[model samples]
Target: MASIVAQVGADRSEAAWLVSTRREFKYDLAGELRIQLYTTKCSCRRAITWRREADIPDWINQGVKVEMETTTIESSEVKTAIARLREKAPFVYGLTNYVAANLSANVLLALGAGPAIGSAPGWAAAFPAGAGAVWINGAALMSSVTPDELDEAAATAHKAGTPWVLDPVAIGAGASEYDAILASLARRLDAVIAVSGEVDYLCDPAGRATAVPGGDAKMPQVTGTGCSLGALSAAFCAVVDPFTAAAAAHVAFATAGERAGERATGTASFAIAFVDELSLL
Candidate 1:
């Protein structure tokens, strides 16, 4: 009576199971799927394939045919995303920290996107509905707007069906407020970025996660780079799907950063070169 279930999304589908009892793989047959993992996050990665009837794994129902294929974000899609972003010049509304706001706006301008920073009363709910895309930085929310405004902005963005990216900044260790904000936004999740060192995991609501790896060694030395990246993500999201947009932004920024790094001697000069590189691209 064991069965396999697949929850399908627009671009991807996934079926996962708990690693049972250190000795077996358990399957349920009650016409309901239950997911419980011993570990919070699975580090071991595997390919899901059930090619032919004879090749099917022992755990799977042999009579059932599981169609599995990984659809990744291609370089061509990145190129298309860039082209569309420049063509559309998406109006990006950002709720970013004051210290980084100017630089973030300059970055968006160089990338051919109109950037607007919002902090005024009633701006959160109104601007997102009008923007091509929105980026909400938790650091900015903590300093500028009231606590409830972040929820309002996220809800408004979700209700408007606008593509928005929430940059959690720091996940833990002194960022409990940010984590609390994310916990509240969980139900209204659209696109979220997961960073593991230089590589970024762009994840969509449907569980489609793509790893886009690209960055310069000196890129972190500059100020406002992270904020700028979030705004760039918003601009790209306006033109393409969230996953592709995140990939394209990372790719684009890396390309610019690498070029700038090669030309500049110090972080101060590299910052200037980075903006110049973005515009030149």
Candidate 2:
């Protein structure tokens, strides 16, 4: 599935298949299924709609009130936000002490979007409560966040009604603990706006994600990591709703990966250049 998304994120029709497939699995038999697509002036340049009924297409065409709320942010506003982030410095707090997360956060700032990278449950609650958006990168397990901690963070983000982006980094990596934490968070948080990952260890009933073929991008396994996707998430959340935020973020990264792969460069340069390129997209 990750391979499919990585390959198809740039191709609208193919990407739609992944969205619809995931929606069917995620929603189960609970609702009617309908799929809609939108055009956005962003890195990916496309949008997707998934409904659980046969009339969804008609509803979308009719501008049904329920489905009309999803919006695509103007490129200018995105540029404005990116410009704001460029001025502020990003601070980091998480289990994974690796500089990549911090670097990614800064890149997000450089491109646009204020970032708060705290894993302490208290800070997590406070940040998302007031923040316009939030990104939870489970890349670093950091002594295994308790169920209570994950719940508190998810709850705080949910209550604030802010966009929540979940990055289950390296779930397929050696850390079973990280995967466990992600599972708990997934079960506890019913309203995850969007999620991105390298492996398919976990996913929503909708199963919406844009993944890549492992080890093909030639980065140190740290290049173009969660930070890029998280930044893209921030981009959408800053302008659009969560679902759109998630979809756009996923597509942006996937498209970037496709672009990067086309060049066959090292991950470090690819990751850095990718952020700059994606922001403009």
Candidate 3:
């Protein structure tokens, strides 16, 4: 499914619109015009031309109530947010796994943010002192940091009023205990929980959620995608609210992954292309 929305009047003509090629239309509004085209294949290049105003259904103008309120961030809004993030150049501190540390740092830097990877006994507690945001990757800490130390670090970040992002890598894949620990930490701080998979899900402390879909299938074959997302989320948090930050990171990475996949032949090349695409953003 794909959708295009446009206002019927000249007064609102200049207002921006959102184009989504997803399976569902979720929103919280009334009297909005939605033109949906159903296609068996999911392709961004598929075009649906609108000829005239009479082509629109009469019920679309009559108005309807939607129980679910889903907001798709406009491309313009994401562009503005990306520019703001580049201008702010906030410092993002990460506690990522060894496998993803390098890529995570590079991704943060590519997005025009300062990256600091620290996992010393007390580094997490001290790093966030002057950092714009903190990122905690449990996959990396499984061997490096103790549970108590990780808790202390999260507590320190919470007390310092710094926004943090938690990436529960492999949340439902035989990591129930670890998942609970991260979930508990998420509730204690102003944090964004980024759960990466075929469909990335981001949720704020208040339980509001955003879903980002559309990425290369090779994403799972590559290492550190989740970790890079966590770092990018922190980078975005430096300039925007946690929810917006998470959503932006998701869209940016997913979009970049798709572009990178088109140019690369294998995992190694895809990884390189992914970073290049991120920098171009």
Candidate 4:
């Protein structure tokens, strides 16, 4: 019997992310690299059994079983994005919230991008024009900064042909106004949205959808991961299209989260290890 340690989602019958199968694997989503683990060809299908100590132990009683399909963590578009980012070392301007400011910059720097968190009077208009990419987190308005600056940044990035990323998280104050602004900016880019979960769904402007799998549940327990994701996506946007940037960023993050979770004793270690894994990638 091949004892495979695989993590399954709450509902395994549905298409879930298969995490770790005693070996490295890869999956593809949004035309980007994905890591599909656990399902490999064998003469005896019944001999395969999966175990997840962290989430679930067995699904035998639930009448659910593992699925088939496997690939390698080999050459991928994500690597290509990383290469371009390191080569060009693009300048990414971030308008992040008070809480996420430092970590977001750290993440971008680890990914080999120059992170510029600017808030000067003309920073919004001037930064994006020269920045290879821009990142605007709606939660930044939670601080003293006004939403108007965010609008100016997004507008300038759009006009200057600089790829940018938006994470509309924790829009605490002036929710309606921020919503309207996010909607307006999203419309210009065709409003592609991503809902992160155990299985991340990446929807494109052209109405195409793809699912990316991997990531540890402990990721959410840490602060600033959402903002970090936006920063990473900004780095990706500097090298690739926004759609591919979003998908590749998600994949890279998931892979890092998974690796970090594997050896981390707690959340603190996991957070540190997460950044290390991203740098290694």
Candidate 5:
């Protein structure tokens, strides 16, 4: 005889079945098993019997019961970290593309952080002097900061041990030279790289990668979401480690996007709710 076990959802209930002959099995949402038994008739009189466990073993049941609780614990921790971020209200310096500058600054402000924008050489070095974190966004619309300015800003953040976030918007799409500059900065500076797309990819200084999935389909239709993500990253980075900051920012933004889409009629409405949700957090 053989036995099989299946779990339902967050509930601890389980269904186990014992089989003696070839049969098929199926399950319902409540975790109850439906089995079909097959047998062959014998010429001589004979009897067959089947048995099942009254309940699942304690060890097996306990294993499945803890998954949901663990997830809850993780989510609670993230919320606590966000509270700390709001309490600190750290300053986040941005050298972002013009298209995203306003949105990025507003995101930082809504999240209870200070936002400062400057791309000049003097500002690059001076901004990090008393800032909690620095963000460099390379998604220019008309003009962009020179490669040297980016390097200088990165060097300043590195020296100060300030957590920095890099958003290389369309880096390799057409600007190979600029892409090279951003790539080089990523390798040298200890910063979080937030690669925005259908799914956001976050890379830490040690080369560890974490994928954050989930967002509204309309998110891409709206500009500056990626930029807001970078700004939010800096907000979290001010109070948490770079890796956790990046992942937390992604989770916050993706969840807010999903929620905003539910109430929005169009892209413009969605954008408004997106910022509102960030402030609500």
Candidate 6:
């Protein structure tokens, strides 16, 4: 006999609905209610059975217990699948010299990714072995941190076989240095994951971005359009194969951004709404 388990809201009778049974069966829900049934080629019937396990074991050992009572069997396979996807969650590293960078990191965590924040050259080595993807934000640059640090970090992530996402906040908005840094990182990395209207350097692999034109425009203005992109990348990296992860991340971000727009009036509103909407995804 096979068992199908689902959440509280699912239909329990579907087990037999599509199957043609030669005999009888039972079902259980939350270990309380039991429904027993008998089926023939021409008709089907059900009756209540004993609520205790001892009474059900008589038919259980014979593999007919399923036909004797109605207890819900939780499907462990679905849990296993979710776990397997989670096992691949990316070790997200953020490099920025701005306080806003902290907000970006928090965004990653809120979206269900593993986030590491710091701009130390030492962090570069950790990228290859520990993370599935890296987010490099050129928002606030430290002259003490040479441009080579960005190059080395991107290169290390690539060598470690992880994808790197670059967030060049306000690149052309007079932050020429930031734009240059973004471009340099983009050229060094195998492929870049960037947001729209930022540094127009990278081509998104379709499903890798999370920003759109509508909504409050408040959240996007506050968090770099790249913030959602990075978080979405992190989320998809947890659930899918590399190729599809980029695409899935983009879809998730875009949909949520659009939804956030509908419910928000500005960045502050979007910030609150964005978090609320993520759980929906």
Off by over 4 Å in 2: 1-99, 119-121, 143-148, 170-216, 261-264
lDDT of 3 at 146: 56
Candidate 1, residues 1-281, lDDT tens digits: the string is 10111111111101111101111111222323222112114454333233323443343332222122222334788778877878998888887678778878988999789998868888887997888877766557446565466556655766676666655443221121222222222212222423323444343334444554555677766766766776787788688755566567767776787788899999899889999988877
lDDT of 5 by residue, 89-152 (tens): 9998877668778877877887788999767658877886578877765443235576556556
The TM-scores, one per candidate, come to 0.64, 0.47, 0.64, 0.66, 0.62, 0.50
Model 6 scores a TM of 0.50
Off by over 4 Å in 4: 1-75, 170-191, 205-208
For residue 211, give model 4's deviation from the true position in Å: 1.8
Q: Whole-model lDDT for model 5 versus the true structure?
A: 0.53
In candidate 6, position 235 carries an lDDT of 41
Query: Would you list the C-alpha lDDT of every candidate in the order shown?
Result: 0.55, 0.38, 0.56, 0.58, 0.53, 0.41
- Kindly give the number of clashing pairs for every candidate: 0, 13, 1, 6, 0, 24
User: Candidate 4, clashing residue pairs?
Assistant: 26-34, 26-35, 26-36, 27-34, 27-35, 28-34
Question: Which scores better on TM-score, 4 or 5?
Answer: 4
Better of 1 and 2 by lDDT: 1
For candidate 6, the per-residue lDDT at 75 reads: 24
The sequence of per-residue lDDT tens digits that candidate 4 reaches over residues 211-260 is 56788988877777867787877777777755566667777778888899
Maximum-lDDT candidate: 4
Best by TM-score: 4
Residue 65 of candidate 3: its Cα lDDT? 19
